[model samples]
Target chain A: MKKLINDPKNVVDESVAGFGLAHPDIVTVSADPLFVARAQGASQGKVGIVSGGGSGHEPLHAGFVGFGMLSAAVPGPVFTSPTPDPIVAATLASDGGAGVLHIVKNYTGDVLNFETAADLADAEGVRVVSVIVDDDVAVKDSLYTAGRRGVAGTVVVEKVAGAAAERGDDLDAVAAIATRANANTRSMGVALTSGTVPHAGEPSFVLPEDEIEIGIGIHGEPGRERIKLEPADGIVDRLLAPILEDLPFASGDKVLLFVNGMGGTPLVEQYIVYRHAAEVLAEKGIEVARSLVGSFVTSLEMQGVSLTVTRLDDELTELWDAPVETAALRWGR
Target chain B: MKKLINDPKNVVDESVAGFGLAHPDIVTVSADPLFVARAQGASQGKVGIVSGGGSGHEPLHAGFVGFGMLSAAVPGPVFTSPTPDPIVAATLASDGGAGVLHIVKNYTGDVLNFETAADLADAEGVRVVSVIVDDDVAVKDSLYTAGRRGVAGTVVVEKVAGAAAERGDDLDAVAAIATRANANTRSMGVALTSGTVPHAGEPSFVLPEDEIEIGIGIHGEPGRERIKLEPADGIVDRLLAPILEDLPFASGDKVLLFVNGMGGTPLVEQYIVYRHAAEVLAEKGIEVARSLVGSFVTSLEMQGVSLTVTRLDDELTELWDAPVETAALRWGR
Candidate 1:
């Protein structure tokens, strides 16, 4: 695999250290290979929030750690979930005298690892709650299948739950918001080009210049469909039709609209996608209460975009508008 | 150009529309192509904020809009600044009652376009204050040249200024804070592989698998140097030594460290880089007040990372912690 570095074996360790050095004030590296930020008195009854997955997607688990976000973000290998030990360590490090909430995206490996960590944390008497995010609408809930995969909507879940925790809510409240947010949201993505994983050292898959993959997952996983490239308007219809159909969003219902770039897609193109998406929404008589069109969550250098929709009520809207300060997403009261 | 889209022309429009549909609460598209957000009130006062840049980097110019950030984000094509008409339109759409502040990232194309837009706004009797962000350390500053390019540090400037604006700080105060943040910060990036610009339909350039480009601009522009791949620790030194040398930060001075991913590197890798970077900073005796590691601002899907450091004081810290509620970031009391 073609990558920049002195040695492949040390890639994970070095990257974590670099993260601490870069954002020293908001976060600090612990004795364990995880990140912890100085909380606003974690011991003062604030529920700790911890989240982690494979490392390739930057700013997801780690960058989102701060005052109103995750307290600890564990780093695993590229595209690999953090092992049980680091999860346990991170949970321990972020224990603010209150219980800890583990926000695990619904990948099989991530769910399993986080589960193990939660079990271990429970054994240690550290109250731990696990919330699995399964927002992707592309995956069919087959009898044998685990159901839809989690995609970009996890950012929203983290922010809402993080805000709840920051407000000194109990683990139950935070996890409830997280679960509701995950349930209320749906996402679908398409890849115009396959990304090259650094370690794999090759394109995830070779695509002819004109081809595209629809319903893509964040880790360069296979999408639900593949079709020839089309206009922005047509593409938006294809991607959104399923989401709108599945969710049954009604006219005048407020929603959070997210047009996320899959690593490589440019903002200019993202805007174009947004324009067409708005047109589609207008046709449906749906009201867009808030919108985020950019690459908040991403895959590794894959040239494509994902569309996520979250029907928002007053509570979700308030939580969505609540202040947050993380390395990636920041704003609020 | 290996992209995943079915058609090149439809990419941007599709992305933007999809984003609007996803987050209907805090954002929407205006009547104008460039003006983003619902027609309803969003900004705090008449002193509306409008910013734009060539597209590609996510959550920078556009994602930072709503309650506490931007009123409108005028986006141009990938790696190209928005034209004058769009800026003027966005300015008008965002104007509440006070006027407008144009936060311009210091690139030749952006400067020129924003200048033209400011003149147009002036002609319309709308107050327009423009702040140029030039924080890259790659280029040496001398009377003989244009000085440093604006890199990722522009985000800090925008956020601080946006917060100031939200607090009803006059355009002048907001502009001044933005100017100071720009002056206090510096950033430099390196590229491990060239990115593919979708419309251009080609790799920005070819880099041998083992080599990396240092001091890169966000547009995939050539950096100051290209060298063989080195250890993450060594790369940290190579990148940070120059920044530290240039700033000559005093001992015991606090700093905000940012290890930003250039689109493609995974979180695992970013954390590893952080680990090495932290070691380097500790050796320097700098009290790191904050550290951010993630893909905050990105190049289209380049496999690389950039380091941004901002010397912080109490005021900056307070401002950094201020709440915001945009599509990308949200936080506050």
Candidate 2:
């Protein structure tokens, strides 16, 4: 209840407007349907990349729109998926002659809406394609999602796929790279506290002060397991054990490791987790070719951390290293 | 209490080691007298920028080391200023033929230690100058600081001054620009919840559930005022009023507005604060030429936001726009 917002209904409206004003050089906020697109417009002969979900996971969908990243991002309310209108609008706005690709996270609402939007765009001759990301290793089924939930690995897919698209890859090529990344990446998270949904005016869940939730979804959905809080290294091992085994990464494997903070976790702590993660990986003979540690995707003010591992090939590695100019992730630009 | 750290006693040691490992491409961490320096040493004829203080305010002195930011960063233990050895070593390591500039925050320990380091470096035949940042508009005096506490404006001073140094400005020129930036910038902050120091195993301060601390220092020192929790807009107004009045930013004035989160606040909430802040500024006819919103400098996982406004001249604006590559802040590089 100590959240900083007014009316709860206007959080999305005001935040998106504020985001557009702050990064005028990076994005252009559109009217009517409400979507964020590149301020520089579509690149000639380049495929347009579009991705979005609920608004709470910031720097994910919206902040990831700019040169070398997403061409457009359509955000819904805090945790609700956007309707088809905005998705279709974003596709239209970002499309160039090369076509457009829609990156959908694996949640029932998001998947359905984005798929509907892609159909509508393709019918209008936009040549749109959809690639789904289901990288969370936490649960096989959830109250809000079927199969696995899309967690932090979405960031990896966006960066690698965005890099490929920036290199003037065809729509199919971009989608192919994105789908491959989605298949290769796995993420799992632990939450010490639950996030309060703005409109609900209360936390989504509550736990004892000494207990913790392992494998929780970003929205505070129940995880497969809950346990007493442990030390940093032990907790990191718990999160990473399932992920490394799920990916089944072996000796001599080159990988990109992303240690992400759930909104309230500190960077210093994330790095501590990363240090242990690196040690664990080294013991298993897995070499981290590229690594990122920060809060790129987050639940609103949840104190936790998630670990995502993307086994990379030369193509994925080169794409990740390519230039990206976005509000959240920027390099080589 | 819910921090992702190993031993409370080893938080700083492990975290710094982890940071260096994660960013090997950007920095080289030295032992004996620990300091982080650019992986690619000093520029031949350009002045070097060096900074250090307590370790809790992350991405401040350490993450800002690279090509166009600080050449070297010396980190102390959490909430404790580094000793003279590391500071002297950083100054000596970063010093090129053009001399070195130490950007010191106005905290008593930091100022005294950095001054001592400058003296030591000077005796060692390295030309060194120091610029102190006291832009916090909070208390006129506090327990740990004599003047205002140096909060978020340190980021602004580092970026602009680092850019000037990167342009091969002489020692005096770089120090002068840094001084002017420190003088023109003003900041104020409010914390909804206090951050816990690891060793203490408790929050730096405490407030009731419905109460808030206004003008709180980064180290959780007592602020000038405390009041009931308010909405985001009202809170933004409260924080911005003192900063704007102190700066007396006038009509037609161009400024850089930095909305920094104190570790725990989410990006969405920060943008909401920024949205309202822009409205308040436009009402006064001030033009914001540049804006940065993130958790750049933080006090562990404190839930608060700091507002910094830097009045910009043509030279300052150009320097601000110049390409600089660092782990935290990077644009046009």
Candidate 3:
């Protein structure tokens, strides 16, 4: 378990510095201790979007900063939430006078940190709206506990809401879009191999070579059950059945099919999953409007796949079709 | 060595079918021998860009099909070239009556198959042009061979060409743009662990726990040299020095820096590489206009990373910024 790094402690900060240098026009390293928009001059009147959590998921928070996505992304330790100061710094840097929107994934640490940051921003007379993306279908949604944990579907929410903000939509409108994106998207993942958190140089969990854990968390949390590795099509069906049942997608409705890799899976295997995913959808007569596949959101180097289906309407489709220039996504003129 | 696949032979076709079901609006699939396209119809007078290689690079040729990128992708067997007929079918499916442009990555099998299809299309009086992407800096420019081979830089070429074609550029114009994008972009890769090609259920190569290889091909081809795993900053410096020297990037020029994972490398590590890449560029006063860090074009489950830099001009930047709606790249309005 060797890594190519300077110091384990400086990994995130050095990475942010590199990101700033690579896209200086679009971003700048704020002495505020994180990367902020270069156009401190232009953040006014626009509802600033700020999101951050962990450094392992590249292009999630920092790579997402640009025109239509996030205004700033505060860097945290790998798979850990950023401290309150950086979040507050990002909010202040992106406060466009209109307000700021904090999109936090429903991880406990992320939620708590973002909530505190929101409170601090309010104390400073900056209007702050927070939307939590809790789209993972793997966790049970019981009133006794928090709703399903947020997973990769957070990317969908960021894109749609970011578009709403770029279109001059008000803070309320942007928040509404974020809410809708979250409501419409559902995701579930399974880990074939547990990831070794670089600092923790061992497997996250151990499974027999023939077994895979279903309904696993992003950081290789235990899944619902262990099953023999099946064909890709069957694996896709297992993941999607719960998702479709939970969301209750109707016939003739459209969806944005996302086949996301959990770190160690190759594109070849992912395509196999996507293939079966399409078969399942067609059998149900669902119309897929657009499709996305790759490691947009990852859990270190966990060997698995997550399927996120975002039901699309005319508006969502249009927003999804909007052009964005970022390190992770780029399209539309 | 276990995989989530029923049979290796049916992987590509089944995956194509699943993709069609998942993206019906953007693509339509035929059953007899699989081929796909956007149901909205190809853009009129726009050069229909098509590309394909082995089926292992998921979300690549197939996942990239949509509004602005590839119109059709002819998928081959795993790590093998797609048959000639499928290439012809993909061309026919995407030819919008304007003409068609083929974005072929430089490989002997791919070049020959695409050339054959272009000749067949020419016989049918269809205007067809092919641009071979040979941007891998790992290969030396030798008269004895066709110079350096094309690798990850093909993605940048497809993206830029897709933007040009989507803007209603003619075949010649799109082909020219693709050629320039290919020329301006250079990539070099190195693997830590060998990728297990699906059909071959084992590691592609073996390295001890401490050693790493530099200037390796995405496929399991041998690299320029093997060395002990070093600090990320030094690793990136070693990799980028050859690319920068070969391409001769000048001071103050804008470049797109991509630190792509070879499946098994974690983003945390990729970020370390990105951080070092930025510092090295800063030391030379070279500026990166945009940077992408993720697993875009991967080589199975290889524990490696590839660095690609494309010199950007205003036109190239605009084209790069153009909005594309695909299974892989979706952003921009």
Candidate 4:
């Protein structure tokens, strides 16, 4: 694996340290427990939002930590879930007078660990709410997840829920918003190549040169099927079809069409995917009220694109338009 | 060869269309003689900043065309300079009563074409000032460049100069600031793998499994040397050494250290590099007053990172902190 890293075992800690250093104004790194908390600490009475998972999908949980977004992020080893300790530490660190909300992807390890952490935090007299995001419409179950794996749509959950939390919503309200966002959203990805895990030093999976995996998960899990390489538009159709149908994002519905690049894909290609996806949505009479096109949630250096469609209500749209100051998703602030 | 593009021939146009679609609030795409102009058009009497070059290095040029940045961007074919016609068109589109300033990267085709476009625009009564950015400290001259090839430092120049122009700097004042930014900045990149041009259907260059190209050009041109793959810190040291020496950055100098990812490299690795680079700078007593990380300028899907440091004075620092709302880079609104 040709990666720009030192001792593979140190990837998470070193990368988190670097992230903290680069965005000192936004976050403070807690090395022992390995969680990134808001530099200014949790706001006095606002509900604190915390989300985390494995480290490979960067700019995810960590990059999303800052004002108007995640209050803290606990990144585990690459593609490996964080233990209950860091999650509890992050939970306590982020708990303001109002409480704390945990937005976790639906991976089994992550869900279990965050649940354990939430229980631990609750024992300490903290009111904690946990929302599991399983928006990937690709599969019903995966190797690492009992249900649909949370892919790019986790970003949407974080953004909308983070905005609610930022507005001083109570823990239950924030959790409800997060759960609602997850229910309204759906995402599916296609990978041209698999990302190599640093520690493993080999691609998580291997595919023939001419085939592409449709409905691929973020952690290189098996997708619905592998098909021969097709044109960009065809691939977009395949990825978007499942997401649109799963959400049943019907005509006249307004939605946020997010075309996320899976690590190695360039922004140019992501735009191409966006163009076709938008065209398809337009044909269905779905108004593209908002759009996000970039590499937000990714699978290490995997080369592909994921299409996420989040059905938007007036309140959701307003919250989506709210100010967010995270490293990965910042706007209006 | 695995890229998310349709007809390799239509990559630029389609990608630019996607860009315009994705960022309708920021830019309006002009088709016939293509150029992405500000959605609000050129602000009357304010110096218009326009930059362009080959298409592959995205978010540079087009992505930078928005408020407090370029008024317009002319993109050529992938890795091929845009023709003088589109350059002239973009120059005309961005020209307000004050004038248009072309921040051309120091490339043979780009420089020649922008020069021709400037003269053509001048003939049509648009005042045009051109600033050639040659900040790459890797080599004095290489394959497609006469002198040093402009690399990531072009982003710094466009940003600082764009801020100056946005604040209503005149043609000369904006040009001077751009030139100063270019003069004070230096950059060097290392590529673990070469990016394949869409049409070419082959990698730009090939390296052994355990080797890396130091000071590699954005176009996959040979760098200072190809050495055995080393630890991330050692590689960061190699890339930073020449950048610091070329600028002869002094102890008292305050600089903006930009760690840019070359498409395929994950943000985690880029931060690893940033961490080490910051440490080295601190050791040298140079304070990092500003920081810009992530893939702003990129070689399509090339797995690498580039380090750019621009010596900042009070004026430049203030301008650097100015609001920029581009598709790729946005902060401090």
TM-score of chain A, all candidates: 0.94, 0.98, 0.94, 0.99
- lDDT tens digits, residues A119-201, model 4? 99999978888999999989898999897889898988998898998887888998999999999999999999999999898
lDDT of 3 at A166: 86
Q: Give the distance in Å from residue B76's predicted Cα in candidate 1 to where it truly belongs.
A: 4.3
lDDT of 3 by residue, A258-312 (tens): 9887777876677678887876787899987788877778877778889999999
lDDT of 3 by residue, B4-69 (tens): 566867766766776676667677776554556666767776778889887666666777788888
- Cα error, candidate 3, residue A235 (Å): 2.2
Assess every candidate by TM-score.
0.79, 0.99, 0.87, 0.99
Q: Please list the C-alpha lDDT of all candidates, in the order they appear.
A: 0.75, 0.91, 0.80, 0.91
Best by DockQ: 4
User: CA lDDT of B108 in candidate 1?
Assistant: 79
Interface RMSD, every prediction, one decimal place: 4.2, 0.9, 2.8, 0.8
User: What's candidate 4's DockQ score?
Assistant: 0.80
Model 3: DockQ against the native?
0.46
Per-residue CA lDDT of candidate 2, range B125-205, in tens?
999999999999988989799988888999989988899999889999999999999989999999989999999998988
Model 2 residue A289 lDDT?
A: 92
Root-mean-square deviation per candidate:
4.8, 1.1, 3.8, 0.8
- Per-candidate DockQ vs. reference: 0.39, 0.79, 0.46, 0.80
Q: What digit string (tens of lDDT, one per residue) describes model 1 on residues A35-117?
A: 55544435357899899887666657777888787888887877787789988988887787789999988877888989999
Error of 2 at B248 (Å): 1.7
Q: Candidate 2 DockQ category?
A: medium
